[model samples]
Target: MANKTYSFYPGCSSQNKASSSNYLVSTNSMCQKLGITLNEVPDWNCCGASIGYGGGGELPRIVLSARNLALSEQHNAGQDMVATCAACWLASREAKERLDHSPQMKADANEALKEAGLEYKGQAQARHMVEVLIEDIGYDALKAGVKKPLQGVKFAGYVGCQTNRPFGIAGESFENPLYLDNLVEAMGGEAVKSYDQKVTCCGGALAFSEPEKSQKQIKDIIESAYDHGADMIVTPCPLCQANVEIYQGEVNKRYGTKFNIPVTYYSQLITVAYGGTAAEAGLNGHVVAPAKLAEIAGK
Candidate 1:
């Protein structure tokens, strides 16, 4: 099949090494192997994140996301806006939802956009990249692209928030999403069914404000995956990956635990499984390092 291209939103994390830069590298590599092209949104700014919701009024938050949509429509017209970050997907998708459904809200957002010399006609459709992979590309196609299966490496598919809540992607259970699990299995890995924290929050942003409570949440997420015999946890959200992976050592120290499970982006796994090198998948930048799967898949 021919390659499918869409307007891409790599989010703040994926944009730089200061954050989840590996996501950008891995995703780009994986998409190349999968025949999906990502044409990044031009001059994209922040989606305002969760704090944007609390600190500012609705119009500001809406405009923050709407600007991207408007720009995509302006520069990359008719292509669906795809995001790898869950917060980015939620913020953008939520803006589209509010803007599309309520004319007054849409008008108000558009009114704000006029100041930026842009207008949001609500033309762009917001989508999670994983949904595009599952709905548009199909799991069978993903399996076929895997040059190296993960084999017996047990995996915990952590969906976290964003992609599930507000609006689920295509055909996924918000409570217990199987898309990640199916993707893992399709790539020739075992998706541990007993891992119950599949859709729980990873204490995003709160990891800074409330380390104790946040660490507890992260600990459970990691411990559960390990308890279920998972060598690592894979997720689609950049925040989830950052929060879960970055805080592991801290969580382990605070809780007197020795949790060493790695947290990885699904794109990272996809890239390597399809015969891409570790550097290509950005494996070198992982906080916990997916050495378990890396050893199996030969990083």
Candidate 2:
């Protein structure tokens, strides 16, 4: 296979949360096998996420997003900027959309970016890892590489807010989305159907920034999944994994329910399905380890 290079953006979440290291390395490994080379944007700053937009206003958002895009453009590796973090993916996407829609805003952002010796030309395309893997790589290719398959394990597909929200601009249909479910099926797992809240927010940003409502939403979703009899919840975003895993105990205590389901990344599941073990996929570190996932997958 030829080397297919893509500009990689490891958002602030992965950089800070050491646990995400496994996911990142695993993704890189998968990409290598699939002939996809990840060229990380160098010296990348925060995408502003929740903070860059409101507190410092939209300028910060534009500046940060432009900076990352400019770095990728400089490399000229590929037009696609592969984003790993959910928040960064959302922020970069929002910045790109707003700047492209408003010429004046684009010019202003570029002018500000002059200080960093960068400019936002709106050429680089933003994409979630899940999107690139499923659409670009194709399910047949992935299935062929599977040294193992998840036959018995049933997974609850959890696509958090940023991945599928804001409706049209995101280029994904929020209501009838099937990429995540498709990924699960490709891995040979039973992509179990859950309630509507399956696509809801993980309450991560809100939990940290706005506690009351965040907890309520998070608790409701967890409890609802439990009620629906899901063996585990699978998500693409690391933020979703962090929020649900860390808060499951608190949610259980508050709601008087067992939110003991494991939360694993889509990549991690693929790794396992491809005959990789829990330690290899970082499943051991998960709050609720899918001990039975391997057996279910016939590994």
Candidate 3:
């Protein structure tokens, strides 16, 4: 496959040493194997994430996403804007949709961009990295690139909320998106086809403000994975990965249940399958170690 370049938007969560830093590491390894180049949008700011529209209001959120789009248009002209974070991609894509449909919103966002000497012409399309992987690269190519296939590992493809609802990857069912499952199969991993909690909400920012409520949701997600006999839970959303993986201890304490399933990003799985080591795939970053992936990576 020919190499492709994109204007990358590494959101706050994926920054170095941040919650999802491992995601960036694994993504870099996966993209390198796939011959994809990610040119980060210079001077990019937050996309306001999932709650931007509610907390910051419409115009401010739009302006924030527009600034990043403007920067990408100027610095990485003619390239699509790609974000690995589900919230960043959703927020930015929603902003772009709003700006494109509403003239007043576009005018207001462009007006705000003037302060930073950047103007958004809406030239670039915002896309999630998973979309690029499945839609642009194709599953056959991904399967062909696998050097060490995950032959026996069972993965529950968790889709979470943001990436599935409102706007989802084209040609996928929002209720039961199978792209992650398909990607797992492409990497020679066993996808839990009957995994029912794939599109369940991981509580997003609610995981902080309302731990009890959010943990309930997370408990359901993890418990379902265990019920399905999944070796690990894989997702495309950083927030989903963090919430589900990090809060298991708390959930166990609260619910008196043992839950220690490894939650990983789809990229990490692909990276390991592409012959990357445990360190290269960022397996050490997991709070609960993915022994299966580590074992696979070691082979």
Candidate 4:
């Protein structure tokens, strides 16, 4: 068991995004067992919530994530900051990149941080907790810690767009990403596939921006999974979870087809299958009942 501790930025989605909460809670539990404590950065705001960047203003991304980063810099100045939300991860990582490479941006960010009694010296590393677990904490070690093995369960790993996109700057491959799949496999479950739509969007805020398109996207993914025999769809995004779960009833009502695929956070499924309580991973809060998941586990 590793004793070194790392800080975490739960991001706004962690609370608003159901699956975000599930991933963070489970990751926290697992990290605790691994001698790693995921402490929250103080007074962090939304990572601009997808709308912060469109207007050509970097302040939202800079200040929001910088506040969190500055907190980590205070205690572990040169250490890495772990992000659970892909959006939050991107925002913070981008901010870190700007601060480290752009001197002018650093000056402005430091001015803003001064308001909160924090300073941004451009030394913190922004990383996905998934990366830390896989790269820093070897896979085999994670296997040894598994109290319950998910040997028979089949999982559909959904990485959503933000986790792996826009190529190199994103820190992971958009075309050949396998972190989620590998994490699932580490827990003793087989990460299954459905269709190309698996990597497609879950309509995100489209319910408000483009309801019809969002619905169609959600419909396509659900139907694709159904066609491909995916027992469940596991994702790391809260927005995707909301779009899929909140609109499942709407999809069913519209299509007259019963579509109730259990959409769970990767951490939630791993936590449950690894002999941890589903509630600990916040599975009960899922709009889609985990009955199918329970059934699979029973087998």
Candidate 5:
């Protein structure tokens, strides 16, 4: 019933039961209540993510994202392409910007797309989910829509890397974004403003290449939230959620510390606070249980 129905690009994380499934699930559930609908782009491929950044091939990375743009333009025309994955948002936006900046580059990307019978004219806009929520749906409206305020629970709004660098949300400070904090306060939770690791990297896929170094970064990310009295960390990025949630226990063991902090998708919190269930929030996928969030929603 929402007037704003965005074309969704699920990216690699939420596909085939991957670690980010919970993010996608909670997103769909929350959007329904918010009067926003997401329509998935058919036959979408990887957004290249950090892997694309490592390739050092300009057109190839742009082309990977272009293919999705082209397909969405073809199928879901006139829509703003909304992505829950931060990497996908960055990749798609970069691809569009590169093409828009140069007609030759756009032509070249289209030529590469010819093999698949698709061509991107850059019709659809690339946007992260949080951008749409905060910009299109203001805090006043969001606060008014909340059925149950998340009281007593403290939260750290982690902004991670992809959505921060090059292009942050329209009106946020890149160095210290407060959209998440604003959202938490809108939902009646105490946002930890002093949590300084807001823009720190979570080691991404590097966790596999260098476990100790990655654990150290994850340690900083997790511990900073706890140090600030945050019961949980909420983010708009699936990669952040996966990296931080899946690694805290390992980091705690390595440093001989006790840390159990839940990294959650903002959509999950919205869904729960909007009178949706714990199951609807997709809390099951979290390695560190967001039981505090579930308990808050119960009231």
Candidate 6:
């Protein structure tokens, strides 16, 4: 396969030492195996996430992502802007849509961009990394790159809220997106097709503001995965992975239910399946380590 490249927009969570830094590491390993190059958009800023709307107001929130689009268009012209973080993709895509549809919003955003010595042409298309993996690089090509097939492993594909609702990956059902399931199967792992709560919200920023209510939602997500006999949970969203994996212990303590399921990104799974080591796959960064993947990589 010929090498493919895109302007990468790794959001705040995936930055160095950030909560989802491991996600970025595993993504690099996965792309290397797939022969993809991620040229980061120069001087990219935060996507403002979903929470940005409330705090920063409508225009500021839109401008935040518009700035990123402007930078990507300026630096990596013609390449699509890809983000691993679901929130980043959502926020950026939402900004582009708003600017393109509304002339006033576009004018206002461009005015703000002038302050940064930049302007929004609205040419860059924002996409989640999973879309690039599934759409740009098909499942057949993904399966062909597997050097270590995940034979006995079973994964519960968790799509979460942001990536599923409003504007999801093209050609996928919003309610039950099977792209994650297909990716798991492509990697030689069993996809828990029966696993429900795949589109359940992990409470996003609410997890920090309202722990009690959010933990309950997290409980349901992890519980469903276990009920489906999944060995681990896989997700495309960095927030979902962190919220689901990091909160298991707390959820267990609060609910008096022992839950220790390893939550991972699809990139990490692909990295392991592509013959990358545990470190390369960033498996060691897990709060609940995916011992199965570590064992596979060690072999």
Q: Which residue segments of model 1 deviate by more than 4 Å?
A: 296-299
Model 3, runs deviating above 4 Å? none
Residue-wise lDDT of candidate 4 within 1-299, one digit each (tens)? 77866777887656745445666677776676677767666666677866676663776567877887888788765568888777788778877877888888888888878887888776678887766777788778877787767766666777777766642223456765676777788887777743456578776666767877788888987887777667777777767777787689988877787998888776676566556666666666777777755543444
Which segments of candidate 4 are over 4 A away from where they belong?
Answer: 16-20, 54-56, 167-172, 295-299
> Tens digits of per-residue lDDT for model 1 on 1-299?
43998999877877776588988998898888888888999999889887787887788988999999999999999899999888888999989989999999988988888999999998899998898889998998888877888887888999898888868777667788789899898888889988999888888888888889888889888888988888889998888888899887898789889887788888887887888887888888876888866675564
In model 5, which regions exceed 4 Å deviation?
none
* Quality of model 2 by C-alpha lDDT: 0.75
What are the lDDT scores of the predictions, listed in order? 0.86, 0.75, 0.93, 0.72, 0.88, 0.93
Find the 10 residues in a row with the least total lDDT in model 3: 49-58
Q: Count steric clashes of candidate 4.
A: 0
TM-score versus the correct structure, for each prediction:
0.97, 0.90, 0.98, 0.88, 0.97, 0.99
Colliding pairs, model 5: none
- lDDT for each residue of candidate 3 in 1-299, tens digit (9 for 90 to 100): 53999999989999999999999999998899889999999989998987666789879978899999999999999999999998899889989999999999999888888998999999999999998998899899889988999999999999998888889989998888889999999999999998999999989998998999999999999988989989999999999999999999999999999998899999999999999999989999999999999999998
Candidate 5 lDDT by residue in tens digits, 1-299: 33588999988888758989999889888899999978899999998887666764789889999999998999999999999898899999999999999999999998989988998987999998998888888888888988888988899999898888889888778899889999999888889999999999988778878889888888898888988899899998888888888877787789987988888988988898899888788888888889999897666
Question: What TM-score does candidate 4 reach?
Answer: 0.88
RMSD to native, candidate 6: 0.8
Give the per-residue lDDT digits (tens) of candidate 2, residues 231-266: 778887777878877787877777787677888788
The TM-score between candidate 3 and the true structure equals 0.98
* Angstrom error at residue 67, model 4: 1.8
